[model samples]
Target: MSGSPYAPHTASETTAMLDAIGVDSEEALFDIPESVRFDGEFGIDAKSEQAARRAVASTLADNDDLTEFLGRGHYDHYVPSVVDHLADRSEFITSYTQYQPEVAQGFLQALFEYQSMLVELTGLEVANCSMYDAATALGEAATLAERLRSISGTRVLVPDLLHEGRRGVLDNYVAGSDLTVETYPTADGNVDREALTEQVDETTAMVYAENPTVRGTIEEGLDTVGDLADEHDALFTLGTDIVALALLEEPASVGADVVVGDGSALGLGSAYGFGLGLFACRGDRELLRQVPGRLVGASEDSDDRRAYTLTLQTREQHIRRERATSNICSNQAWVALRTAMHVASLGPDGLVELANDSVRRARETAGRLDELTGVQAPVHDRHHFREFVARVDQPAEAIAADLEAEGYAVHAVGDHEIQVCVTEANEQALDGFVAAVSEVVR
Candidate 1:
């Protein structure tokens, strides 16, 4: 009686199927505990939409207003107002998958442009329209390495300092495969060339490294890492945000076979949990066929005018079916659009200036903090981008909590190492933050 009326099965048919499966009832098939099982009950009184909104707003208002210098992966950049104005147009925001090429030209073209920007930035030939976030994008890259016929190995090598979220996701992505994720050491917050060389051999399938690594040290020996991967016939994958790509070494030049990381760093500011994954790879035909998510391509229409359409869809929903490269059914098209819009607003010079500012701000802020009696700024002896780790005389956790009490937030990355990120958005509070840190440490 509780079954769907449109289920197409009569009571007798359902009973027969249940009997065939040796289950007395549908509930028997699910092992849900009785205590945790849902029961029809009016647990709370309903409220008007306005009343509900007011309650939520009041709850959110109770959150402390702390100036955040936290950036382990999530970052805050000032998004221009024009990005919001253009991206909010219902036509762009509400548009779903661009399946029908004829009516979806506008969104398809936007995605094409987004792909083009990534292609230009990464120096990789093909860039997908989007991915869920850096975690999933990294997961997809590991699997892509597994799928490539040219790369034959069971090991996926990642830096020892790789963020846990990315490592966890990569672990799950290859859970069903024969690939094993292993860690290589980092020297001075960068790739430990000798250690990495020892780890990557004929048994290695892929080598993954991040520029401006999680510890905020700008990598110095990427060329050697690339050459190492090449020597082993392993696919080299580089992870970085779009903003850093403008000023950092080009991924392709470093022999990166696949490029993946956060692309929303430009348009969306500080989505603590959410992200837009950037995925691109070399134009090798073998590599192109295995790229995940969607790739919007450009071409000429019947009228001889340029046109855009979904060039390659390797997700499960597409023609690939059971043999699909990935199960990524949806993409972050809207986020990609926003990023493209923000990048366009900045232009090349503006982007370069922002990238340069990141380096300068981090260096200057570190210098200011280093001046403190108990603080030794820049735990790593390498150039940093937008952030750096500082060694404090006090426990990093206590220092972080004290800073929060002082209305500032920073990451307690180690026992005495606290990571502070400075961006244009938080630059105004640097003096206050430094003063607070100076006070807190003593």
Candidate 2:
């Protein structure tokens, strides 16, 4: 509908409007308090379009064949050409907000498929279209955490090993929403389950944590936390890397009341580009009603024809603002479709094989690295997904710098740990990575 939201403004009209607003120039409108604004714009010269392209190409000229070795939250994976081709189909690419529900059935149906995929993956009773990403989804989940509880359950518990950015975003979302946010400390870069239990009580709204934590160490025994939240009537929300769930236990089976996670590992190219919302629950009917975003349902039209349509979309943008469950009904549909393709490409059995391959490769990589004189993951012993953190003899960042200089792409995750991510497409790269790491540490 917003074919061009800014089509009303012409260049000359914008200038005239600025002048009428009493600003000397467009730049003058940016005049902020000096304490907040830098005096200079870093003095970078602008280039012509052609010159810019050449300059950008030149910057990357020396690095055409470098193998990537980094995997913190994002990793390199094989995406089907069909994924892009299908997502770019005019039916999906040209559409937005299918409000009429009839004329917009194509987009709505694609979104419905996306939602169904998430339900299958998460094993929850229901999954909506999506949210901004796993982080914002968690923030929304935090709000639901409070709303799901009574006055006694007012505090939210976060694990020490939760992704820092996700935690910060959660804090900001709930700052004015009347809930206390606190992080449980870790024992060895992993959330201390004992500490988590000690703090969570009747006053706690949700016990939020991750497995295969940001520290690259898996947090054990969430069954205990779920039991605790049960006793207190609080929700036990497990945050996770969705792909890891293929190799690890599903949170539902392991005692989580709510399952929230970023599905980027499914196919998101980078952490910031696109995000997947992994939402599931213990399948409570009342609990499912309050869940946010788009919901797709398999239904029969009045004529008794089978169809899929957008279901419980209570987003403010779709419904009355006061009655809206979330303003995020239109989340990651195209992206979720990509995730679905990746998952469907790897069928349930295929997913298990991929998961096993990743776990084995990571374990092998750790074992080989630990054999080196100065590289090891001190915290790695449990089964892992594709990524694992290894402690180097020197600071991990410095070692990473050295590795990158040698045309390697390893990422530093902590003061002393570098992460290695293994995938089906990166076997040769992984071998080169191990050899390169050997030389660097040696």
Candidate 3:
């Protein structure tokens, strides 16, 4: 007890616990290999806070100062400064999980608004406050499909162009369940309807697809994809960012049972790996019960005043472990708050304008790149969103490295193909980026 100040047990209590477990000493409880065990001498000198800040700054400065034109799943849409100002307030940022609705009405209301925003965006009846990210949300959707009494089958079909990270996460999620993930071919960056038709059958559980796919091409004939899934009694899940959801076809209209994507695209501005997973599904009672993450609901208080509270807590932490909808321990509440602030600041019309700009910027940028010799912009024939693939005469990796040398960064997606993403955030640097690309490709 003296040695372990954090441990609650006294010497006799500890001995009793160890005796109950049939271990003579605490050291025997750990099975760690002696060779791999920590020797506990990290040879690092401590530094003052100011000195540490300077050291971190110096290390970060070593990174190349290149304008990134990179986007696959993560995007850097310009976030209004107002979003930061309001969302950073102590009340919003410091609030943890709102278990006590009486004290946490403000944070809960903000989350309710976030859910309402997603509800309208996806045209779905119900929207959870948040999930970990797009990958986890998709994973949750697959499990929901399995849980739904209305749907059946073990096969989860996805587009061939799904982001590898998301695919990997989804694979890890379903590895424990009876579900198996399979890919269907894409035609020119869009779902191949004919090939998809052959793949969908009685065995299909859920059909997952993206609007502007990982290649940045807006999916065509998406309604047909939805229809095909409905034909086989399979659930249709559509993925799209918050901004794109403004201008693209509504997921519900396209027959999507669930809609999941990164809500952070509009608010966070390229928080590279971190994201706010948007999860919404049709409002059917059965579906709502099966939805993952927390849902904030609006209701009347004891005084008959409108109030907000964390409604359906389907996480294993809050409910019976076996009865929980998901084992996800926590959520991106702060990120969701920022996203809601960003969306509210934009309003409906501003959001649509921003989304329109994404389409225009992608097309115009592709057209400019196409004019350069040895570069064919927009390798895909379909309409694009904020990014697109360009075919270059030189090796893609070498061209990307050359572009980096010229103070620009783009993804070398293939042997001769590079994927470029441009939005209002990087629109100011387009001229310099195109000039650099011209020099690199030449």
- Residues 1-442, candidate 2, lDDT per residue (tens digit)? 3224436977788889998998867678785887987776676666766887999999978654556756655656767677778778887767776666667767667667656665666566666547767788788888877666342577888876677778888998788677888888877656676777789787888778777676556667767777887788777788776677776766776677777776767765544336776776655766666777776677777788777667655545556476666666556777776777777777889877877777787788788888888887645566666778788878888888888887777777779878877776676776677788888886
RMSD list, candidates in order:
7.0, 6.7, 5.8
> Could you tell me how far off, in angstroms, the CA of residue 230 lies in candidate 1 after the best superposition?
1.2
Each model's lDDT: 0.90, 0.72, 0.89
Per residue, candidate 3 scores C-alpha lDDT tens digits across 70-140 of 98989898899999998889987887888889999999988888888898999998887568888989998
Output the better candidate (1/2) by TM-score: 1
Candidate 3 — which pairs collide?
Answer: none
- Once model 3 is optimally superposed onto the true structure by TM-score, how far is the C-alpha of residue 288 displaced, in angstroms? 1.3
Candidate 3, 339: how far from true, in Å? 0.6
What order do you get sorting by TM-score, best first? Answer: 3, 1, 2
For model 2, what is the C-alpha lDDT against the true structure?
A: 0.72
Model 3 TM:
0.90
